[model samples]
Target chain A: MERLPAFELKRPTSLAQAIEWLAATPEARAIAGGTDLVPNLRDGIGAPPVLVDLSRVPGFDAYEIRTAGARIGAGVTLARLASDAGVAAALPAVSAAAASIAGPGHRSVATVGGNLCVDTRCVYYNQSEWWRKSNGYCLKHLGDTCHVAPTGTRCHAAYQGDLAPALIACGASVELAGPRGTRTIALEDLYRDDGLAHLALEPGELVVAVAVPAQPRGAMSAYRKARARGAIDFPLAGVAVRLAVDDGRIAAIDVALTGTNSRPFRLAGTAAWVGRAVDDGLLAELGKAVQKQVSPMRTTVTQSNWRRQVASVEAQRLVRDLAKVAS
Target chain B: MAKRVLSFVVNGRLREEAVGDSTLLLDLLREQLGLTGTKRGCDGGECGACTVIVDGRPQLSCLTLAARCDGAHVETVEALAAGGRMSALQAAFHEKLGTQCGFCTPGMIMAAEALLRGNPAPDEATIREALGGNLCRCTGYVKIIEAVQAAAAAGGGR
Candidate 1:
């Protein structure tokens, strides 16, 4: 059994207090759910001198559904997101993505913020400390060179989180609080392409909540992923599709993908599909576009080409399904 | 940074003990309280061997901090037996041959207990989803599913 390294755990009663604590201690890491952070800590991935647990922060667990959209607190558990009636009604893709993550016990404790901020993974990077030492640590952590792309300078670890793609597909934005006070940013912009430094958050900054904008009338969305098992495994390649049909034609469509690269991104050329009818020819072209845009590295144990194919296949299937319902 | 005295109720008994800040709930339950029913398998969230009911929710004890459980109600496999008699869920697991190696039974039962409490008559798909976190290396999960179904059939879900 791997043991977590010792650190001071501070429980803050308010979001302001949590921000202050983080600002005061630069080495402090904010912990929500601790599902990913705990295991990473045990595996010697990080050694933060202090931990600010976010569970005690008031209003952090609040879930509100508005006419515009929904404001989901950072502390809201994945279970709640999956089971919440309003969330299911308004943002079905978000709920489906949350429900697909890990398993029931994990979903009970895993938070939206935690899943959004989950670390990028690579076969060489995520391992026991002893195993890493024996194999020579990767560039994402202590090592100088990346095992995935030995010649390349950039870390190739893949971001396998399921929520980012779904949320990004829905055009969500996140409210972040830091020493500079609070500001909102597009969820897509919150991530960078670098696996070693995936998040664009400033030092001591914390994600407060995610705000999902209102969906268009007649809109339908869904999220799906390929994994080794039915549960308890990260997505090999996850896809989220949101589309609306008006008068028997595709009015709008958004496609986002994860587990294929360092950052989850809304496919750029999806707008080209607008006004087109859902058919076998359109689906084939969509699949080709997806496969062309997504570049899967050798971060996972599975074949990178297989993941790329899976991502395209999933996107086409989801788009087809949602378009059928919308029309 | 320093150890603090934490108070929490386990199996209907209140306990106050000094624990390290880094101490895991699995360690606190198995080591300090001597409640070995919560087995430590992977010691990581990947395996649900240390699953426990906390405030009516099934959580992985290995990933939970002991300090976080303060003032909370926790239920382990030990609480299911009354007067040396196995609870209906436990009895179902026993009678249905759910345990081959018996290592994952405690977690399986605890997870099922939480599920049944929430949805008394969960269908086969629901049971599989609820127990998805728990891994049983011994059996092919046929008997485990049967055990949970049998318990629900016998009105044990209440």
Candidate 2:
């Protein structure tokens, strides 16, 4: 067992206190559900001087269902998000994504905010300190060159989050709180394409909650994740689809993918379906379009070609599934 | 660094201990309190060997900060069974020959306990998904799933 190094732990009962504690130490990090961060700490990936435990913070664990939308607290565990009747009924895609992450033990404690801000992983970067030192570490850490691409200088670690793609597909926004104040930004804007500096959050800013607008009638969403194992492995290629067709024409359609790039974002060519009627051929074409867009490197669980193929298959299946709900 | 006292209820008993910053819940339970039934398979959260029920939810004790457990209730595998007799779930595992090496038994039972508490009757797919994080290399999952099924059939989880 890899032991976590020595550090100071602070449990903050209030959000204000948590923010104050985080701002107090520039090296301090807020941990809602330590599923991701704790393991990273034990892996010697980071050694923060102070760890502000946000698990006890009140009022950040509720899933508030408003008239038009819902506010999902960042502290809400993935298990709760996946199993909550309101969350499942309101946004099944979100529930599906949450459910697909890791397994029961992890989901029960891993929070939505943790999933949103989960670290970008790579084959060369996620190993133990000793393993990386022997493997001639990548640009993600002390080394300069990327093992995946010898010529590449930047870290192309794939973003391994399950919920971010689904949330982005649903046009969700997040409430960010910091020492200065609070502000809400579109979820898509929170991510930068770079794997190293993945989040756009300023220093001391923390994600408070995610706001998901209510899905209109006739709107349906779904998610598909391809992985090597049934349980704990991260997805090789994940595709989340959202679609709504009024009468016979497409009202809206958004597709987002993760584990295929450095950041999860809305899939391109979705505007081609704004007013179009989706046919089986068009669905296959959409799959092909998505396949062409993906250029997976040798950084994930599955092989590069297999990842591309799985992406195409999942995209097509996702569209076919969503089409069933819409029609 | 600062040390804080963690006061939490364990198996219906109030317990208190002072812990440092990076003291894991596993360390608190096994080292501070000498509750070693919870195995440490992977100090990383990948393996479900260190799972303990915290406030009616199953969480990996290895990654849980002991200081964060303030004012909470935790249940370990030792809480099950009375006297020397095994609990129904434990007996079901024994009867079904669920353990080949017995390494994953405690964590598996704890996880199943949480599952059965919430859902007394989970189907095969549900049971499989629920225990997916728990890896067993010896007997495989056929007998383990069968044990859970047998427990559910005997109305054991509730």
Candidate 3:
């Protein structure tokens, strides 16, 4: 059996104490569910000396449904988010994204914050220490050269979180608790294109919770992911579509694509369809238009062109699904 | 390395032991306590061979640290049978030929156990969705679904 390297574990029960502990210990990594961090630690990705378990922190698992929107604690399990009645009814795209994550067992243990802040994956990067050592390591692990893009000086690892696209489409923001204080950032601004330092969070800061504002009155939400295999795999390409229809016409639509670029990318062309009546024909053109924004490299096992095609397919399917909703 | 006492209820029994920071719940069940029913497949979360019920939910044991299970209630496949009797789900698995490799049985049973406990009369789609995490390579899941449905039809474990 593969074993994880030994480290110090701290279980802080309060949020303030957790913040204090994180602020004081620069060598400590805050772990919510450990679904991503633990495996990565074992696989030799950032092996912090201490792991601060955030699962026991008070109020970390609360899923409070507000009048205008829903506030999901960072530590809330993906399973809970997927199954919560209020979350499903209010934000179907969020629910769908949560449910579509890994599988039942993973969703049971994986958390929303972790998913939002999951490490970027490159075929060259996520491997055992032995495999990486034998292959001379990639730029993601401080190696001199990147296997994905040998000419590039920086890492080209792809960010493949399932929730960010949907959350960004719904106009979500994250509350972060850090040593300095608490600050909230629009979900779109929280991420950078760099996979090595993907998040814009300062050291010792943790994502406290994510807030998804209320769905607009004429809103229709849907999330779609295309995977090579049927189950238990990450999406090769994913699409999250949130459409607002008013007076029997499209008020607005926000389309975000995942797994295709370094960071979540929203289609600027969605503005063109602001006041247009969308049909299957317009959706087809929109799908192709959306595909133009994605530039998928050889990040995962799926070919770049294949993933681009999938992005188009997913976009078309999403727009068609949104068109089904009665305006 | 720091060592901490992990006190949790296992199989309806309160068990406490000092676990290291790197100790996974799978190691605790298979090595320390001698409940080796949960097989470790893809020690990463890819495979569901190490599934267990933690507080009425089926989660991966490999991904869970023992120290994190402090004061929690954990149910492994070990607890499914009592007094020389197999659980209804186990009996159904056997009667319906649910195992060929027999490696994923424990995890499958535990996942199905949690589902049946929550929803006694789950339909085929529900059963399949509940057991979606558990993968049986030898048996292509048809018989496993049948076994779970059979168990549900047979009152789904008293």
Candidate 4:
């Protein structure tokens, strides 16, 4: 049976103490839910000397939905968010994204922050310790060579997080606490293009909470993903769309995608097409833009080309479906 | 690693023990406490074989640290029967031929037990959603779903 390596666990009473513990131990990693980190630890992927348990941290469990928007705590469980009617009514995309993660058991313990900070995964990198050792590892871990690209210097592991794209599409921002202080950044800016150093957080910085600003009136959003199975599988490709139509024309639209590249990004071409009519030609053009922008590599077991095409199609379908529902 | 005094209730019995920081709840249940009913299929969160009810929620015991469940009420498969008689869900599984090899039965039952407690009259779709994390090699899930439905029909879900 696989086992976790030895490490000291510290349960801090406050966010400040958690930050202190992290700063004190450079190898320490904050654990909100062990849903993701624990498995990686068993695979011998990362060996942090200390695990700061954030469950005891006060003020990190709040889940509020207001007219302005929502303030979701880092410690809010995915199950709770998925089951909440208010979250479903207000931010259906976020709720659906939460509901679509792993399964019921995983959702019970998995947290909002953990899903947002889920590690970039690859077929080569997510193997067992024995398998990784036999393969001599890869550029993402102890090894020097990149098996995916062979000659590439950087790790091409894909960031397959489900929550980020939905949150980013809804114009969310993250509140971060660190040894330095507290600050907020647009959720899209929280990530970088590098899979190895994907999160733009500094050492000892922790994602304290996520703040989602209110959407425009009469807007609707939803998220969808394609995977190998009906459940318990990571997304091969996922898309989230927020659309507000005024007089049967696009008044506002935001689209974001995951499982394509090293970072979940807002589609950069949406702003120019805001006022265009939602038609078959416009949807075809949107699909082409998606296919052109997304760069999926050999990260998942699914074919990269298939994933890219699926992303484009899913994006177009979501836009058309949401527009139909609104009209 | 620092050892902390842990206290929790298991199957309506309270126990206290010193646990290392890294001691998983699965190990504590199977090794230290001698409750081997919770099978460790993947030893990771991928498989639902090591599932148990922690604080009325079905959670992957292998993914949970024993220290994290300090004051929680935990229920395992051993608590299902009373007076050596199989509970309604267990009997439904036994009579409905839900167990082909029986390795994944305990976890499946525990997950169903949690679901029944929350939603006594779950439909077929709800049953599938609740057991989504559990993988069955045999019976093709038809009998398992039938077993859960039968148990709910017998008033055991309450």
Tens digits of per-residue lDDT, candidate 2, B79-111, equal 987788888789899999998899888899999
Query: What is the DockQ of the complex in model 1?
Result: 0.81
lDDT tens digits, residue span B2-121, model 4: 799999999999999899999999999999999999999988787798889999999999999999999999999999998988998999999999999999999999999999999988
Ranking according to lDDT, highest score first = 4, 1, 2, 3
Against the reference, the lDDT scores of all candidates come to 0.92, 0.86, 0.86, 0.92
* lDDT tens digits by residue: candidate 1, A86-181: 888888889999999998888998999999999999999889999998998989989999988899999989999999999999999999999898
Candidate 2, A1-327: lDDT as tens digits: 477888888778888999998998998888888888888888888788988877888978877876598999999989888888877777888989999999888888889999999999888888899999898777888788888888876778888799998998888999999988999999989988777889999888899999998776678888889888878878888988888988777888888888877888788888888787778878877878888887678887569889888888898888777776777
Cα lDDT of model 1 by residue, B1-158, tens digit? 56889999999999999999999999999999999999999887877989999999999999999998899999999999999888889999999999999999999999999999988899999999999999999999999999999999988643
Better of 1 and 3 by TM-score: 1
Best-matching candidate per lDDT: 4
Q: Is candidate 2 or candidate 4 better by TM-score?
A: 4
| CAPRI quality band, candidate 1 | high
Residue-by-residue lDDT tens digits, candidate 4, A232-305:
87888999999999999899999999999999999987988888889999899999999998989988878999
Query: Against the hidden reference, what TM-scores do the models get?
Result: 0.98, 0.96, 0.97, 0.99
For every candidate structure, what is the RMSD over all alpha carbons to the true structure, in angstroms?
A: 1.0, 1.6, 1.5, 1.0
Better of 1 and 4 by lDDT: 4
Model 4 chain A — which ten-residue stretch has the worst lDDT? A268-277
Worst 10-residue lDDT window, candidate 4 chain B: B149-158
The native-contact fraction of candidate 4 is 0.80
Off by over 4 Å in 2: none
